[model samples]
Target: MTTQSLDESGNDDTIDWLDNGPVKGKSAPTRMCLATREHMPVSRLIRFVRSPDGDVVPDLAAKLPGRGVWVRADRDALAGLLTSKSGFARGFKQSVQVSEDLVEQVDLQLLQRCQASLGLAKRSGAIILGFDQVRNELQKRRPGWLLEASDGAQDGRRRIVGLAVALYERVRVATALAGEELGMAFGRDHVVHGLLKTGQFTDVWTKDYRRLYEFRRLTDDVWVSGTVGKNV
Candidate 1:
């Protein structure tokens, strides 16, 4: 559902989507859908506030000395914090230091996590990189997902895309993926090609990717828009 607050001129504004489904009409900050604690399985939908040290810690983690502020997880949700300062401040019942880089921090965290998973996948041999090598892997495993580089050449990417389409549900470009980063996954320092296989590592990567991509799609739809919706 949509959550809203009035702007300086008193106009209603939309908050980012923090929960299930898009909020109708109004904007609301997005909240984490999973449990607050790492040990719990039950879903606790709580909005996290950025701590003074610029850390996004969960309030339930500890009873800190001072009051905490709430923010949605996406960029739009963070933007809501800037525009609807009065409303959010009212909700917190205290003053909060809202920095412009709050959402950037969150974005960085998500990207890092995704990259780490890619690294793990590489270590496990569930992922392969490089043009010819990855294509060969694709032919063998017929992977459930494909990862093309965001900065890869159009014709080169298309040739792989065509192979993926031939294999159906088993190919995608890694738009949020960095060529250099993917290369590091396999012990290299630079790369633009990669392949993903269905295995324990793939399962783990897919789950983490689900959460990361979901949040990314909500805010920065540009990176994940076309490639993520299908195949990968």
Candidate 2:
């Protein structure tokens, strides 16, 4: 199944695999960004659709029903979607209400999705919380990813990351979320450090984290999935 919308140039855009959007081990197909006019993997784009009340909304999971508009997952691309007066109206070929805070909303949505992925890890016994437990996992457990509170002191983070780097081929550390934010997934007041065991949830978390990092980072640096270029 597919859904249709328009790019900035008013070209008919179709997402061939939008029915479920790469769910259940299916490969993600590509969609054209309304802003960039470039076709990229659906995982690298954010889907938008008109709500019942004519409001433009982000369909982060890409499962929302209706014809969908797409933009690259980058913050700049999304912002450019609303630059001209016509903007979404021109793409949708109808009047639509876009919230002034739409960009902020997308950022929060991606962050929440990242946290929700951690919740899945916790439920599956795939997560280790606390500084000491995470450190122990770094030493013994074949961890897939490292989670650290953005607001936590750098001392603990440096030690844990150093150990993870020494032991693993690549240490995927995410410090974009704060202690209280990470804690919400584990039902704690504060969680500064965490480790995720190699499994399905880790992969999901990585994707969400990458999108969040791309949306929030100030620099033009892109987030690559290989060889720790920089901490996210």
Candidate 3:
């Protein structure tokens, strides 16, 4: 993984998740609850535990046995985990294993969860796809958020964005999961256009996306302030 120093002002984004305990804990040992403040979504926050080697694993299947540890599901959160060793260790009340590559694993899990959720949403007709279809959905009513594929053609996405401006309250362009990842969300080999259905599950999905987006932005060396809008 590539590493770059970030401006101190923007470092706060990582800190925000740490304060919130974003990792596996809500439904079971494996399922992580995505939490956020306000109507906007946040990252996948659930409970977790440190491994003997210091690995931060997402207990998706809830099969891993042990007391769970909580982190923000981002690199900075991993850094915090490393820094506050005494606190976390005390919380676990045992010799918890910590891995150096914990952050990378969490990132991969985050992407996988996004893709998997997208696939489920697509299967349930919770997602609308293609530029034209998405445009039509926009006409029906403004959606809670707008999602665009980061790898999509600029012109195509721009056209869709124009339609979204009138129909959606917020827009989020996803870069983590591109063409194939987008398609998997809908059970297709490849997909570009997709919209999510509103429900409790969807709320959690949105929050996870928001957290992933912010973490990606920070790690990518793009310093963005204010709420996420058009462009990733």
Candidate whose lDDT is highest? 2
- CA lDDT, every model vs. true structure: 0.52, 0.75, 0.53
Quickly count the clashes in candidate 3. Answer: 27
Q: What's the distance in Å from true for residue 103, model 1?
A: 1.6
- Per-residue error at 171 for model 1, in Å? 3.8
What are the per-residue Cα lDDT tens digits for candidate 2 across 182-212?
Answer: 8987888899998888888877887888778
User: lDDT value for candidate 2?
Assistant: 0.75
TM-score of 2: 0.82
Worst 10 residues of 3 by lDDT: 33-42
Stretches of candidate 2 exceeding 4 Å from the true structure: 1-25, 218-226, 229-232
lDDT over C-alpha atoms for residue 2 of model 3? 19
Candidate RMSDs in order: 9.0, 5.2, 8.8
TM-scores for all candidates: the values are 0.62, 0.82, 0.62
Scored by lDDT, model 1 comes in at: 0.52
Candidate 1 TM-score to native: 0.62
| Per-residue accuracy of model 3 over 58-104 as CA lDDT, tens digit each | 55433466656444445565566555534344444434455556566
Top of the candidates by TM-score: 2
- What is candidate 3's local distance difference test score? 0.53
